[model samples]
Structure formats: structure tokens, C-alpha cells
Target: MAAMLTQFEDLAADNTSGATELIQRILALCESGAMGNTYNEIREGLNLLEDAHSSMPSLHTVIQILKSEFLPGLKNADDLEQSLRYIVSLQKILEESGAQIAEKFLSVLERPTRILTISRSSTVISALKKAHKANKLSHLYVLEARPAYEGWRTVRDCSAAGISSTLMVDAAMGEAVQTAEAVVIGADSVSSDGYLLNKTGTLPLAICASEFGLPLYVLCDSLKFSPQTRRDVTIDEHPDSEVIEKEESDAFKVWNRYFEWVPINYVEAFITERGVFPPEELEALSTEETAADE
Candidate 1:
């Protein structure tokens, strides 16, 4: 149990893994009977994850399920077994959602098209690979997301999948946008005001894409949508050491914000497991969901 908790702690500290991947691992941990034997223990485990990755709405969804649906039912050994089965079912659902999102995303692409994207999203990568497989994707341009540099992982995955891709610095988004036919990105969360809360470079990428009249699509499942407004959302600031080796001094101060908001007007569409929709439609959907919950 101690070892399992330590492993989960390390996973929480990881900044590179996408939210989908992290949620899957969290479900696996719960199914392994390693989270804890009692409700408090499991709750603590979930709390650790929430604290570490507050920006991930999908992860918060998983945590909510475990807390509201599973934790309350964990009374006996038989109950624990039932909870594990529930976790397994949820994991399968998430997997299917990912595949569905990829399929929907592929349907929107023009044949032999080039795509430009920033940061690393498991869902976006899955869709790009699917498009490549279908012969609809000709080339991919990846922006090397700084701080965590997760774009390197995206390029590696693209290469392994035999997809033609180019890696460029985040600042080269203006140039990359001009070369690609469209922009596709992944969202950490879609804010209540219909803005995208994602990697720090996404706002600039969106600006470039919009200025060039290139369609910018956000690929994510509905689980990534948050009921919180932009002001309510927490934007994590990583260590200053990630930006510079030198400590803060009278000479300079390093600011290392990991995420930022991109205006909804910059996005042309949002491709999700359910279907593709425009920003206005998503805004209505978000409003409906919030009202229903209230």
C-alpha cells in the first residue's frame, strides 16, 4: 500500500503526461486495490491528484466519479470488489470516448492536408495518427511547448507512427500557421465563458491562425469542459528554475506560468466524442449542463 501511494505521488508530480493518460493511470491504480482500504484513504489519494493537477478537468471528472459513486459504496470486501468493477467500466468508457473523438476529428479533415499544433494532447495525437492512417494527413508541424517540452514527446510519437512531422520552437507559430491548412489543439479545460484553458503558447497560436484565416479546431471530449468561469479556474505556475537556472535577484525575476486562456472567437470548431460544434453551440451546451447541475 505504501509503495502504491508513493507511485501515485510520483505520477502526480509528472508534468508531461496528458490528462487522458493520467486519468487512465488513476483508474488503473484504483482497480489495483492500492488506493486504500477505507474511504478516507481513497479520498486522500484523490485529493493529492486534484491538488497537483488542478487544471485538468478530465482528471477532476474521474476523481468526482471515484468520490461520489465508488467511495461511498466501499463498505466491505465485496463492496470493494464492486467498486473495482465500476472503475474498470469507467476506464473502458474513457477509452471508447478517445477513439470516438479521433474518428470524429478525422472526418473533418481534407484529404492530404497539413496540420499545425502546439503542446501535447493524447487525444490530438490519436486523431492525427488516425488521419495519417486514412491518408488524409500529409504533414504535421509541432510547436515545442516549453517549460515541460512535451512537444518533443509528440514528435517522437509521430515518428514512431510513421507520420511526417516537423518540430519548431513555440515562437515560430506565426510561420508554422502560414504553412499549415489548419490548426488543431487539445484543451485542458473549456471555460464557462467558452475560452480554451490550455498550454501557454495556445493563445498566440490561435491569434496567428485567426489572422491567417486558418480554421482552429479544439479536440477534446466533453469531459474536458468545466463549469467554472475563467476567474474560478486555477492556472498553475511552475518552478522558476524551469525558465532559468539563476535565482531571483535585483537584476531579474522569472515568471513561469504553464497555462493561459485563448478566446473562443479564435476557435472555428470543437471536435468531441459526441460530434463537432462551433463555439456558440458549445457555450449553450455548457450553460445547459451548468443549469441542470444547479
Candidate 2:
């Protein structure tokens, strides 16, 4: 963990210089369950993000709000570190909050579960490895999660390992689920109820899979488990301004965020390193689940 933090510190020292790369790297580490080093660096780097732009009121207000109301009165590096880690762990908390509840549910399931992997995400990779070791990885299906063409990563990775896989476009999930026993996906964040917050098109996929009588499974680590209330929680829309902005579209709101969320109801199961459970049971298992990450 300390080693991970050092790497994060190096990358996060400047938000604009390579913030996205650093974030990508940090996510890679966190997904691997060896993020001890990155945890601290990410926490420390929050200060850098808060200072990313000196002129943006929205950014400034968020930082100020974090300092004043959310994590007020922090004095030392350690306290600040803990606070920042907590903030970063918001996604983690949402992703994998169950312990007791999972233990209860998981105890009833047999090994060698069949899962149809739809999206390619670090979270998906993490789940694949864990389930593979635990004798649960049955099959992997690659959804051509597109626009950015990220699903290809999953297909490539799985194929390299000789894992049986089939590639489909973003639209074929509903049809594919007919043969699929279960639909498994990775999450960018797991809402308190285990609603899978992930890439923009994930929710529709989950919905389609659900309607097809397939169980929607979310494979996540507990760090993404958010304890916060889900009352209109804001999703950060990213700058698509760089994409079509140069294409002469409307100058305003041209950009979009990198992700979207599927509410918790469609989720049938959530598998985490700690355990697995129904989405509604997340908050009840904070015991075996420790809050540490970014």
C-alpha cells in the first residue's frame, strides 16, 4: 500500500500534467487489491485536484465545501489522509459494502457459478481473477462497449488467457442473455444499495439482461461502496468539449461524463473480495469490510 501511495504521489503532484493518467493508474492499482501505496497518494492528491483550476467557481466551491462541511477541522497529514481516503472511497464504498449480508448469502451458493461478462472494466478484471481462483468463472462474454471502444480490452485480455469469449456490439446484450446464465459486470462505483454505477451504457445492458430473465451480477470491491444517501447524487459529466467542440457543435454542454449508473433494483448479486450479496444488503456488512482506498 505504501508503495502504491508513492507512485500515486508522483503522478498526482500535478492535476493537469497527467491527472487522467494518474487516475487511470491509481484505478488499476485499486482494482488489483494492492493499492496501499496509492491510497495515501490519492488522498494527498485531492489537494492538488482542489487546486486544479484557480478560476472555476464550481470546482472551487466543491473544494471549499469539502474542507468546510464534509471534512472539517482536519489538522495533520494523517487526519487529512484519512479524510481524503474516505472521500475517494466513496466509489469503493458504493461498489462493495456488504460483509455480513454477503457472508450470509454467499454461504448458500455453490461454487463454479456461470457468469456472462458484458463489459470490460478494471472492476471486471478484478472479479474475473477472484472468481477464477474461487472456482466460479464459467464463461466470459465481451460486449463491444463502444464509442471509446473499451470492451475490446476485455476481449483481448480474456482471449490472451485462452478464456472462451464471444464479442458483440453494445446492442446485443438482451438477445445474448438468453443463453447466458448470469450477467456480470464491473462497477465504477457501487451505490449503497449496490446499484452499479459504471460506464454510460451499463444500465441499459443490465435492464436488458434482467428482462431476459438473467440475473444481473455486479462484481466489485468493497471500496466503491458509498455510504452516502442516494438523494440525487450527482454524476460528474466530463468535458466532451474536447470531442465535438472542435467540430462546431453548440459551444455549451457539448461534453459529457464518462459514466452512468444503473439503480440497485436490477442487480441480483454483487461479488466482492470480502463476500457477495444482494444490492439491498450493502450497508449491513461494514464489519468485515474495512474502509480504505481511492
The candidate scoring highest on lDDT is 1
Residue pairs with backbone overlap in model 1? none
What is the C-alpha lDDT profile of model 1 across 19-59, one tens digit per residue? 88888888877766533664555667777887888777768
lDDT of 2 by residue, 1-294 (tens): 566556545643422221112344444544332223333344454465554432122233434544453344244445555555655664354335432323333443366655566545555555465555555656677777655556777778776765667787877777677767777776655555445566667778777877878877675555456554344346654456434545555556554544566788888877776666776677666544644321
In candidate 2, how many Å is residue 171 off? 1.8
lDDT of 2: 0.55
Q: Which 10 consecutive residues of model 2 have the lowest summed lDDT?
A: 14-23
Q: Which ranges of candidate 1 are over 4 A from the true structure?
A: 34-41, 247-250, 287-294
Model 2, stretches more than 4 Å misplaced? 1-24, 27-46, 49-114, 129-138, 231-233, 239-255, 286-294
